[model samples]
Target: MRILSGMRPTGKLHIGHLVGALENWVRLQEEGNECFYFVADWHALTTHYDDVSRLKEYTRDLVRGFLACGIDPEKSVVFVQSGVKEHAELALLFSMIVSVSRLERIPTYKEIKKELNYKDLSTAGFLIYPVLQAADILIYKAEGVPVGEDQVYHIELTREIARRFNHLYAEVFPEPDAILSRVPKLPGTDGRKMSKSYGNIINLEISEIELERTILRMMTDPARVRRTDPGNPENCPVWRYHQAFDISEEESKWVWEGCTTAKIGCVDCKRLLLKNMKKKLIPIWENFSRIDEDPRYVDDVILEGTKRAREVARQTMEEVRKAMNLMF
Candidate 1:
């Protein structure tokens, strides 16, 4: 089955990105499925259009991160969203099929408005992002889209658009289903959602010294002021990291019991979590080093992927033109 997904080229990825999407992408490829992963440079504009001078640089960094995280270019079609013009064409055609009232109804639209706190989010491009996303999926006629629960609504919208297009003209697309990933929400050192915007993320390519320092400084249970005071592991953000990274239940059990009974201090608990976490990231760290050593290799990989992707995209667009009677 053909699967498609993308991430905005915002900045360097953190642990949240690893568990949330990259790992899932690698698993799908290893399972012998066709995967199309791209740097969503165009999507980044829906919000960050004000400053794009660094956009190209960020896009390159995003691809490097993708490669470092084990997204084999040989097994997956990886490219930049803006590299293929068909995405824009399909998105424009899809815009006519979807209603303004419908776009306004999407829950995320309101959320974005609030998040940005911009008095006027009336930009046509921003409003139609869901339509653009639909183009990203249907242009490939993708069978499945791996996403978190927050994105299920967009998948529903995509299915509706596909159904509308097929009903109006021809069966040119397969309605893609949302494959919800089992991604744990990793918190930052500040005890907030691990986000670059928050300045508390532990980057994927961070040096060992920085990684250790960040883990050591991470927020723990605030109520347990003294080492002797019994702590609540449930309230500690560090405990969350332990649960997400520690593979052995026995180790997790040890951390839980030790923390709850005052047998272990916050520093000790963090040291254990850091130990388990470092082993998981060793390969990614090595890959990051390799990518830095040879930058041109990353460029070659994206170019090759774009070449392969364009071939399929062109075929799909031909069918799309015929379905809409635009063959002339």
Candidate 2:
């Protein structure tokens, strides 16, 4: 299947971000899917509008993270969204087709407004992001999108936009489907969503010691204050992570039973979790450090990706202009 997905290159990506999305993207590519993964720098502008000095830095780091995490550059078309000018032009055209009220009703827009508390800076860019995303996906005429559970609404809207466009103009675009990725729910140290703003994330760049320290401070069953106190793995946020990071099946079964029966202390559980986490990340961390040290090699890759992406985007825009009768 032809799949399109993007990650916002705004900050250091955390474990939650990886298990939630990127890992799945890599797996899909490995399974012989045509995947288009881009650094969604334009999407970052919706929130971080004033502070864009880090765009280049963040984009660079995100690309490094992708490579580090086994997102093979050969299997996937990784490009920068802003590098393709057609994304902007196509987004503008898509905005005309979609209604303002529809964008307002989106759950994500409301959530971001509350999260950022951006009473005044809730600009049109923030509201129309999903449309831009639709433009990004439809530009390639993606057969499907790899997205988190939160993004299903936006994809549903994208499907609607495709249907409307096909019915009104011509069937030039395919009605893209959402390939729901069942990603593990990785929580923060503070038991909130693992985000940079929350300041509770374990970034991929974190060292072995730092990773262990972060996991050690994790909150488990709040009621289980003592080692002897029986805990509920179902209620323990840290236990949720054990299911995610540890060896996935039988060996993990040992940790699960131990946690619920008070046979294992929180520290022991975290230690077990940390060992598994480190083992998984060591190679990825090595890959990132290699790219981090050599900036030129990564830059060359981005430039090549940008050039290839532009060619495809330009051809799609030609078809778009003709369909809209704007190809004069």
Candidate 3:
């Protein structure tokens, strides 16, 4: 399958990013699928346009994170979104075909605006980002887009756009399907959705001491005010982490029994989780350290991937122009 997915270059990737997206991406590539993963730098501008200073730094950091998390450049095409000018061109073309009302109806549009009320998200770019996302998928003629549940709607929009384009012009793009991620969303230490804006993420680059402190401080069942009080693991955010971090069935049952019976305190539960999490994250951090030390290696990977992506994008644009009678 020709699979495509991307992440915004907003900030350093956290454990949420790993469990939610990167791990799934690595699995797809390893499964022998054709994957095109890019850093959505242009998409980042939709929200963070005010601060262009750290954009480059964030983009590089994102790429480094991808490399560190076992997203082998050899197996997948890894590029920055802005590196391909075709994305912008195709987006402009797609914008005309898509309706303003349709874009507004997207659930995330309203939700994100409410979430980021502090920022002025009234820009046209912010509203029509789904169109650009469609261009991102269709440009590569991706058959499947590996996305979380929240992003499934965007893929649906992409399919709508694809059908519209094909109906109006000629069949120049594939109506891509959403390959829903198997991993559930990972929450932050504060028990809210894991997000950079929330300031609750456990970044991949976090130190061991910081990781320990963060895990220990994670929110547990609000009802369990005292150590003696029995806790509900279902309500505890730490328990959610256990579910995500490959905790064994036996260990999970033990934790559940202990929590419900007040046999284990939140601190001990956190400590146990911390030990298990470190075993998985430490290797990824080691990989990140090695890649971070060599900036040129990361740059080369981006340059090569961008070139390859552009080759495919340019061909798609040619077919699109021919289909739309714009070749003249």
Candidate 4:
């Protein structure tokens, strides 16, 4: 399957990113599927256009995160979205075919507008991002898009756009399907959705000491105010981490029995969870350290991948032009 997915270079990636998306991406690439992963720099502009001083820095960190998490550049095409100009051209062409009402109806667009109400999100670019996303997937003629549940609607819209384009012009693009991730969303330390804005994220580049402190401070079952009080693991955010990190069956059973029976205190449970998490995250941090030190290596990877992506994108644009009678 030709799979494509991307992430905005808004800030440093967090543990939520590692398990929620990066792990899944690495699994897909290892499964022998063709993958195209790009940093959505243009998409970042939809929200962070006001201050772009750190845009290049964030982009570099994002690529580092990708490589550190085992997204092998040799196996997958990793590039920047704006590096290939075809994405902008395709998005412009798609805008004419898609309705303003359709874009307005997208749940994410409405949700983001509310979430970032402080920001001036009244721009046309902010509203039509889904159209650009469609261009991102369709430009590569991707058969499947690896996305979380929140993004399934965007893939649906992409399919609609593909169908419309084919109906109006010619069959040049595939109606891509959403390959839903099996992993559930990882929560922030504060037990809410992990977001940079929340300031509750555990970034991938966090120090071991900070990781320990963060995990130790994670929110637990609110009902259990005293150490003597029995706790429900279901309501405890630490327990959720244990589950996400794949704590062994024996250890999991111990945690469940202990939490419900008041045999284990929240601190001890958190300590155990911390140990298990470190085993998984330490290697990724090490990989990131080596990659971060070598900026040239990161540049070479992006340069090569962008060139390769442009080759495929150019061919797609040619077919699109011929279908729409834009070719001279």
Candidate 5:
């Protein structure tokens, strides 16, 4: 099946990114699927339009990081979303078919605006961003979109757009389904959500020692006042990491028991987490460290992927124009 996935450029990736998506990308790329992965630079602008200075650097870093994490550009098509001007052009075309109310109904839109504390929700591009997302999927004729539950709403809108186009024009697109990833959980240093804005993220490039130090600061059961205090693992962030990373069922059970019995302090639990995280991230870091040295590699990869993506996009747009009679 054709799988479509992407990550926005954020300078360097982190454990949250891995647990959230990159690990899943690696698995799917290896699963013999035609994966179309792109750096969603445009989407980054939706949130960070004020900070355009780091975009190019972040874009390059994202490409390199994905390469380092075993997303072989050879096996999958990797490109930048804005490389082809057609994405924006098609986004405009799709905007006409979707309603403002529909865009408002996107659950994440309000959540993002409130979370980001934006000065205004007035950016036209920001509000209707899902239309651009639809154009991205439909352009690739993607059979499935590999995403987390958070993005299910966006893909649903994409399906609606595809359905609308088919009903208005011809049977030109497929209704893509959300291929939810069997993703692992990756938390931040503070044991909250791993986000760049939070400054609690363990970047993919940081040393193992740094990874350990970050884990050490993670929040635990507040009820556990002292090391001797028995705590509930259910409320500990460190325990959450164990649930995601600890492979041995016995080990996890031990964590639960130790925490519930106050045998292990949150510090020890965090130390254990850092050790396991290093085991997972060290190899990816090693593979991707030299990626930036290749000056032409990112450009070449984007050019090739864009070439193929544009071909598919052109085919779709041809039908769209013919159906809408743009050229007749």
Candidate 6:
């Protein structure tokens, strides 16, 4: 099966990115599926158009993170979204098919505008990002897209665009389905959704000393004033980290019992989580360190992947042109 997914190149990835997307992507590639993972640089511009300075650096770092997390370039095609012109071409065609009213009606559109505190999000690019997303999926005819539930509406919109194109022109693209990741939302140290914009994220490239400090500083049950006070693990972010990192059912239960019975202090609980987390993180740090030193290795991967992706994209565009009678 051909699977398509991507992440925006806004900043260095964090633990939330690891648990939410990278882990699932690695699993899919290991399963022998044809995976196309790209750096969504164009998508980043939709919201971050004001800043172009860090875009290149972020794109490179994102690719490095993919390599560090075991997304093999041999098994998966990893490219930049804007590397091939077909994406924009198809996006332009799709923009004509999707109605502006429909784009405005998307739940996240208004939410994003408000979240960013934009007095007006009336930009043509911002509104039609979903169309570009649909083009990204359909251009490859991806059978599945790995995403969180927050992106279900975008996938639905992709399906709608595919349906409209096939009905109007030819059956050129498949309506991809959303392959939901079962991973829970990895919260920040502040117990909110881990995001760079929030300034609460623990970046993947953090030093061991920083990691220890970050975990120790993580939000716990505010109601628990003393080590003797019983706490609800459900309300604690440390408990959430344990759920994702600690694979041992017995140890997990131990954490629950210890926290609830006031048998262990929050410091002890964080130490346990830190131990398990380091066991996994040490290898990623090692890999990223090696990859970071070798810039040409990342460049080679992007170039090769772009070559492979363009071959498929060009063919799809040919068919699209033939169907729409655009070729003179």
The local lDDT score (0 to 100) that residue 19 gets in candidate 5 is 76
Off by over 4 Å in 1: 118-120
Q: Which ten residues in a row have the lowest lDDT in candidate 6?
A: 180-189
Q: TM-score of the candidate numbered 2? A: 0.96
Off by over 4 Å in 5: 184-186
Ranking by TM-score: 4, 3, 6, 2, 1, 5
Instruction: List clash counts for every candidate, in order.
Output: 0, 0, 0, 0, 0, 0
**How would you order the candidates by lDDT, starting with the best?**
4, 3, 6, 1, 2, 5
Candidate 3, residues 1-328, lDDT tens digits: the string is: 9999999988888888888888889999999999999999999999999998999999988988999999999899999999999999999999999999999999999999999999999999999999999999999999988888899899999999999989998988888988765565888898998877688899888999999988888999997899989989989889889988889999898899999999988998998899889989999989987986875999999999999999999999899888878854
In angstroms, the error of model 5 at 170 is: 0.9
C-alpha TM-scores of all predictions: 0.95, 0.96, 0.97, 0.97, 0.94, 0.97
lDDT of 4 at 134: 98
Selected candidate, larger lDDT, 3 vs 6: 3
RMSD in angstroms, all models? 1.6, 1.5, 1.2, 1.1, 1.8, 1.3
**Model 6: per-residue Cα lDDT over 1-328, one tens digit each:** 9999999999889888888888889999999999999999999999889889999999988998999999999999999998989999999999988888999999989888988885456789999999999999999999999998789899999999999999999999988999876574778888887777788998888999999988898889986899899999999988888877754888888889998999989999999999999988999999988987876999899999999999999999999999999964
Q: Cα deviation of 297 in candidate 5 (Å)? A: 2.2
lDDT values, one for every candidate: 0.88, 0.84, 0.91, 0.92, 0.82, 0.90
Q: What is the Cα root-mean-square deviation between model 6 and the actual structure?
A: 1.3
82-145: candidate 5 lDDT, tens digit per residue: 8877788789989999999999989999988888884565699799888988888888888899
